[model samples]
Target chain A: MQQSQAPISSSSAVNRRGLRPRLTLLLGGILGIILLLDLEPYATRWLQPGGDIIFWDLHFPRVFAAAIGGIALSWSGLMMQTLFRNPLAGPFLIGITPGATFGVALVTYLGASMGLEDSGTSFALQPLAALGGAMLVLSIQLLLQKKLTQLHSLLLVGLVLGYFFGAAVDIITQTAQAQQVKQFVMWGMGGFDRVLPSQLILLGSSALIGLLILLYHRHAFNAYLLGDIHVESAGKSVKNLRLWLIIGSASMAAIVTAYCGPVSFVGLIAPHLSRKIQGTESHGPNILTSAFAGAALTLTADLLANQLIPNTVLPINAILSIIGAPVVIFMLARKD
Target chain B: MKTQRVLSAITTLSALILGLASCGEHPRDANKSDIVWIKNAYATLFRVGYSGTDSFLELYTDAQSKKIAGAFHWGTSAAIQGYEKLKDRSKIVSLSAIHTGMLAELNAHRHLVGVESRKYIAHPLLQEKSTINSLSEVAPDGPILPEKLAFCNPTLMFGTLSSIEDKQAIERQAKGKFSVLWCNNHLENHPLGRAEWIIAFGWVMGKAEKAQGQFNTVKKDYESLVVEAKKSAGTHPKVITNCVYNGMWFVPQYSSYVSQFIRDAGGEPITAENGTGSNVVNIEKAVGLFSEADIWINTDLCTTLNCLKSSDPRVQHIKAFRNGKAYHFNKQLQANGSNPYWDMGCIYPNRILSDLFHIFRDDLPTDSTYYYDICK
Candidate 1:
């Protein structure tokens, strides 16, 4: 119980506490799985062209992408919120999304200047460019997070960096050709459909390892809340802990942005919803709850985007906004 | 005499291209040549109600969404009520290069003074004009600015309902100086229907006879080619088109113009599972269709086999890629990404159909005259 109350090592490893929170995660996960299984865009038995490819190659990879994305964004949001002790804190606040967007736009501009076909296979390189951009900008924030004595300075810097990257994206949009701009816009819409069958291994394993490390050191994130000295006192290498935390959040945001494009609102809304739903002071349920919430919300949004119309695949961002804004508004309105 | 002259010219071209007789079909033989009637042979989105040279033209669009998108009209006919009047046709602003190409096909090139997408204009005539290059991209969120369009001093503007700019909003912005006519030439289900939009463009440009003449010759050429393509020996290859762009794999629908060409060319074309406009699917479904294909066409932006492999590594296993059967229509693409395949290809469906036909057949030469070529 003392370990449970401590800043690191939750004893959440084998504890039977937080039943409702645990159940919420389990049910949310189950619901997510069910929704993913049902995603068959081609109404007929056309999927029978390849044996269970509809599941293995198509839906499986897509579901893996969404789940991983959800976990990454939601966990990153939780980390940001806890470190800042602010409810409004999210991954996008650190300028990761904007930086990633700018990177994608920059690549489009370069390609256009090189006179490459605007809407062609050349877009295959966008994922790499986006990942590189997200990491570069995020690393600056993380380095400052380590160097700066105060969280407020880091927060202010992130806010400013968000603006900087935003202006950069806007500049690119203005100069690029209409066809080239259309490519960036399409990439911004974000979807799980972009994930390939081959990418599941890397994304899935990384997400699993991240989840396990967090689960085993259940109270480690709470120590992250207390900063570097506390993590060192709790028999953990402060440097390693800091590195892990920064890398985890940065990698999650970058990988999701690169593979699935910038999925907005999931990172911002999930942690807040998790805190409200968990209804407890213990940070033990915070990571798992928010990660589950993120996965469930994103999966539902994707399902709705696919099935809302007869044969149309609407943009995921549009559907997420529709689903997320209402939940956020209701939670705020209730203040329950 | 004019009809005879046009027919004679067409006969000569048909004889040169297909080496077959096309004189068997003639509209003037059945109807009075002096009546001056222009009818659409295959277009479904466009309907001409009257028989006279100056008649009401009805445009069909999306009506179910309650956005007020279907069946509009513009003409001088006072008899037809609820139709918008397009008073002046001296100058025109084409939003799409396809329309500009169609107008040029009718020898009404003088009417196209403004265009929203001047960069896409790959026609040598328009590209060499030099003044056409100055038609800047004017719209911020949509396709046109009223002030910029006003600067062009155009009488008619051809717009599409698909853009973010609403038709009513454009009508308000253009005011009386110009009228906005919504054209959905790309949305046509049949290849000939898309080509037949030239006739409507002709009517607007006061070149109805010229448009009809061009449409008739092409239609005859297309049908004859379809029949000739069917006569070739051996089985037609399984055909798939287009590569992934921005995560979505778009293919031609079964009833689409692309599929009709494949069917006519004696080849099997993999079609979208559903939908009419922009057949989109994820990679999984597309891969299922792609693997079954023996030949690929319209591979998006891949000018070479190396480019195709880079777009999707799975193409390496696709029979088309392995056999060097992958092809694209960017043969005449310029440094600025202006491919006449889309510009002129819309006006000449027969040329593309012939290209596909010859490519699909093993005995014939694979190299196309224009538009399509092998991605070596």
Candidate 2:
């Protein structure tokens, strides 16, 4: 039996391919519905004191703040993975979270007696301190690049810095008053719930700037993906591209770390999920997908966390750890 | 000239002999008038098996010994009873009254020289007259500043079991400066010990007869109340005494002074099984033990009805909560105007028993009036 393909059937195959855009729009619409339904009223009631219109207006900024945080962290994850060629890299791995934690602890435990006016200011400045701390480590790694050939050295350095910062935090917490320590412990639980409305502007603006920088350098990102030697052989400046990528990633990491606390695993896992879903090695699709997925995942997890106990809310990190750890493990297993 | 000089010398010699003779006569006269007899009032009043009825006669007889310049009363209720007995005989120049209302009796307005703490130093009269000093601040290591104490020249010091620990320090501080007396009204250190100490204070104040009468009255009243409580004991409801700290509930253990109040009131204490320690137990354990108890008594300083209403939330969970059976201790009974309640009420367990019996025992023939008023 012989089968003959008709010219009309070939044209229908092209039309079916054209329907992919509508399918994507439908999938996005469903996810957007889930996000809007899960987040809006619940976040509104949880953060704002009263159901008054004025209070709801005040709560709007925090919603946008978290949205901005989700985008920045996802984009930062994408940039770091592209630059480092490592899927497990994120703000926490680079010692940024611990560094920021240490800054907050120092101010909380020691600053009051030292006559610091605003204790929360120290917490707000943590990301700046963390950026410096991460850069210092990064610079040290760069300096030792000739001496240390293994990527494990950089990872080990980051680990040691994290432990060192952690020990410093412990010392600060030990001398703190019982009540103050309890508060610090609660904040350390890591959630978007603590972000104030006023911080939205700063978080949103920095995230926008970082996204624009990454978008503008999209060609350089593609060049670097082919390897530094190949890009340099193609007559593009690999060193300049690497520098810009690191700066962009570091800034994005710092902004998110400052506002939303260290949202562990989202930065590491979201990019990988995006790459797998897109089934393409292209950075543009990966970036867009990762941003959407990260926001969706964070919003969904936060929703589940809020709903778990009827009146009481658990930390967002606890939920993320449960969901994120398993997905990352599965992905790694599949890659192997 | 020689004859004139001899006349002058003779006159001078005669004047000197007359002066010596007058001086000798003056000594004899002074001995007769000023040598008053010294009295041992305490020893006479507190003699073995001595009753409190003859306290007045003992005090009057002791008055003939010497004018009592000052007196130190340190015994708890015994001091109050002793002061009342000797109020006419002695001008109580200085006193260290520990109980709340006991200071009101001194009537020496503003004469209170020292206090245990700021929380306990709210007397209007004492506030005007005395410079407040905390017992801890003045005598952290003991031998309370005798010089500071000497300024007031307190002849007597009154204290409860709580102050018993500082007795030696007080005495050392008062050595040669003042006398220290022990008041055992709480009887907490001993069940029947407080009434006996009243006799001792009476003897010290030379009011043995008056102390004996007061002691007899209290003893008789307590015995009758105990009998009444025992009669209706079976109908007495079980009670849990507690206060809130942070979010946790602190239940009184079996052996606390509060437990005695509960038991004497004819109610069984829920924590009675723990056996008389004052350590606060956890809420879970307390709830487990007293979940079925008929009443929850908030023994905190809830002086008013309003204050009792605003008490900690944990109070709402007890069975007593559903029935509104919670009772707060009235603060009015803290002291009799110038006397310490700890010395008086704390030492005299019978009075506390009577109050508790009135509150808890149904159909008990106890005084219905609360000795202390709830703050409200």
Candidate 3:
């Protein structure tokens, strides 16, 4: 699976790869320690013995979900950027997260209109709603790609769809009651700590499965990076590969968004960080490196958001944007 | 590509199916005349109210409902309207926010199921509606779910009908056959006018005479409190409200009902210069207001001064915080976070006024506050 247009010599590339994985492991260890030790005054019970209910119910799920969700979103972002050959492309930048948002809006608003806004059943099915919304956008993108020759044009379609879904969400928010609107707004702000203990395993497994699929097709991604001509000459249908990649990436985003809300930074920033650190376009190393980096960033962000105020939990998305926006700009500037 | 098309088509179809499924409404069935209505505060803002066999009551529209919902004294407008309209007000089985002004009325009718705050729960006169049946032991953990309310099996649901959850419950249980009176009480700007919602409540319950009579006493008591507050010629304490939630500070507008209480209690309220609704400002601006203010109220459910300070240490710099004049509207709370101060506080602005007057004036012998507790 070695690239024909490789920039670095084989020996140097191998040595760099060996060093990057160790750095990633070190970063992951430091992040894990930060997350575990940075408990708020009220969350002290999380570390005490016989705190199973507290740990399993209140704490572990959130930390695990944040790490897993970050890995999934970063992995998806890598797949998206590689497939589109566009550095800026990520799930949230396109319509995938918005599609998930739309699905939640559908359930929330439609339920509100029918006078069932506060029903437990409505909240219980949020993951399904998110998945449906995500699938809707993914399907549209797949269908449109068949006719449109340019991938950048496809990016335009995703942006437009994002706006359409966003508008729909706003309209429904206006019609819904104050409490219901508040719930939706909180969900939109995005947080990792919202996942329930019951949902942790399901979300973790889905993310793991998505990560495995990406790992298996690491060679395919390398071939696609070489361009569609290379991939076609290798007897792989570029069209089918693109479709599968979209599905895989969109599914990861949708699942994480459904469980933990629409996180921003991991999907867009982590992949860039991976490529920068690895200094190569190889999917194998970049994929693992991005996942580890994404997890570290998210865990650290979640810790800050949780403990920034003594009693109040600040929105995770707000903290992520504060962190992610500058990183993206810096990357663009450095690339420039 | 063929496989991709097939999968894409399937995904679209699945989205449509889910969309349609979510659009489904819970089936409701009930006879309007046979059911009684229970209401939350927000639902009282609409013009129309409940429908019964003998009447389709238009709450805010009718001259009587309008007059009472306009009045600030709890049950006063209802009492006045009941005398003119000649209806029994006692049949209105609505949850009362138990406060001083309505204590007499509520005590007189022990059948009424009131949502008492923790302070009022200990009141000697707290109504003992058939303890086995009248009281809903299932305290709803969050916003009143339809099921918790369904236990009441209300025939005439009185509210603004704005909450989709409440609407669905009524729809499913009553099957579009029950009466849902729109109570637009929150819309009334006049302190007395906001209290007059009892007239609408009276009409629903067929207890006009009792509602009117009860409201008259509240009017008299509330007027006397106002008269007492008017005697304070000293400087009006600069008042601020609410603490930060999720890093944003929300202060009520000058036109807000809470500000009206501050004004009536002889205190100057700090509000946003513009906007008729709550103003969302950053922490720095909110802290500036807090530091400058003489008194702070409604510290976002922070019952203790320590809770307030711990949430934001900058609050310690406020004059109100140093003077121990910071108060919370959470004088009464349930373990589940339900506070009747919200439910009944609107019905008795005079009590809230009395509470604020006590908080602001050092000259006056401190009166027992009904809805506020000094955060210390």
Candidate 4:
């Protein structure tokens, strides 16, 4: 029972946590399989002395982006689900993604109107701006959640915030020049291939930081699952824990959205699918399983998006929506 | 006698271009001349009112159908572009008007007989030119309406591919009453190739000799302009065209009209790839291409250098912007705010080439023939 109440290391619970390890390996195996399957052709085409620019510039950067983006969004989704104690809470659903998008659009569209190149270093500060916007929406949602006791009310408020941010983005885009509007609109469509080799370090670092934060609060997360009362009883400030949780989760979502263009449904689908596979409420197995599931799902969606058409990448958001919506329906239909 | 003189001159040019025997296709007998003025080679087929006779033609357009009707018909429908610009307006009959402000002018000129749409009455450009304005008018969003067009009673209708489906609907309504012949001259990648369609149009109007004469002049002028431009080939600058639209920068294909103009003007055109048509690359790729260029031309709809920079500040990063080589087609605007570059330049590519030569080659004599000017 203490194993469920506290965070347990693999050394202390080998036999009892056999499912977690197997689930991790299975999800990890799927991710590996997809990466290898997708990369083998590109890898074979890669010239040793840097002969092929397409292999190096296009394919290699794309693979890492998909993997890293998947991990970040799915892990962020898990954090949001636990923090809100709602199965349906997600970055997109809860206004965090829209806020990040609004932030990027502001710089991309409004900045261009101010005579800044949408393609140049003016767009380089997008992640920070996205983080600010994500935080703005997340803080408002959290503050409103204190008054609105109902889970659906909070979701509704988040949806309203999403609409508001979306309207702001539209207004900003209307004033932008045509090319900037095209860039803004394309960025809204979401794709993995947009991440250049230079952007990978920032994306990878954000994911690593978010994961570390989640791991650091692993114990507090498990305690909070029992309710805010149980978390307080354990001598933790519920408000502080919630704040950190939201910040960590929102940052992860913001970073991914800012770089990859508001990836749809991955944040909502990955955790639920991971929870079903792991079949546990504990943070260690759930988080690991969810992260792997998220990575696997994103990579697979990205692979389908890439391969579905030759030489053209289908939008990642569209592919994810097609794959993610059905799994959500299945989860809702299940008696559990 | 004037027609005979022009015909004789065209006969010489046609003999050189199409061979002597082909030039002799001009009818010799007076009876044949009245019955079939143009030969089948240059003549376009019209539906001719379901009677299977290809004869009379009528044309309608949004503002201007590129002065197409005026070139073929002595006086185009009063509703078309060139009625006032190129033709004797008194000789032209009134057709449907799309803009209400223009409709009042049409009425004042005793030419307001038909209207294409009652849906859109307010036109921003037309409002600026004329006092007669309507609050609400149905604008032609799709093809020319069969009902509105019925009033025009055209034997032949001219339209572009954009209105191909709409033209089909009109064909269905007219069914033997008219034939819609879409002018695909713009599809020609070469400037002369586009202008040469005027000969094809003239043939339809039983004016093949006149069309041939006009085309000969255009050919001679264009070839002379090319020869003048090539003189400064060694000093040609690198030129890029068109500003960013919706974050994707459009560069003319190597074979496009503008690119050909750039080449003939003794300047090298910068393109992302050796594509046959315009390429729409994102801002990043566009920035890379634009940065290396010496001059930028056709920054579409951007009136000033500051406006161009505001569209994308990275425009300032380009050598063209830094060196003040940014130019736009803001020189010749119609009363209704339409760019005559598309209207007039299509007919006179020689002038376009002359302007580019002036821009690219400092050695060239600067003339008042520029269709474009520096974006301040």
Leading candidate by DockQ = 1
For each candidate, the alpha-carbon lDDT, in order, equals 0.71, 0.54, 0.65, 0.64
**lDDT tens digits, residue span B62-128, model 3:** 3335443221112212222221222222322233233222433444334333231222233334433
CAPRI classification of candidate 1: acceptable
Model 1 C-alpha lDDT per residue in residues B298-346, reported as the tens digit of each score? 8866678877766555555567888898888877888766888887777
Evaluated against the true structure, the overall lDDT of model 3 is: 0.65
Cα displacement (Å) at residue B115, model 4: 14
Task: Score candidate 3 by TM-score against the native.
Answer: 0.52
lDDT of 2 by residue, A26-66 (tens): 54665587567655664555544333422333334434545
Ranked by TM-score from best down, the candidates are 1, 4, 3, 2
True contacts kept of 3: 0.00
TM-score against truth, every candidate = 0.80, 0.45, 0.52, 0.62
Q: Each candidate's chain B TM-score?
A: 0.81, 0.57, 0.65, 0.65
Quote the lDDT for B309 in model 3.
Answer: 59
Worst 10 residues of 1 chain B by lDDT: B23-32
User: Fnat per model, in the order given?
Assistant: 0.34, 0.00, 0.00, 0.01
Range of the 10 consecutive residues with the lowest summed lDDT in candidate 3 chain A: A1-10
Off by over 4 Å in 2: A1-27, A39-58, A115-153, B1-376
Clashing pairs in 1: A10-A219
**lDDT tens per residue, model 4, B203-291:** 34445566667767877888888897776477668899988533346677776778998998888898766644676554444654567
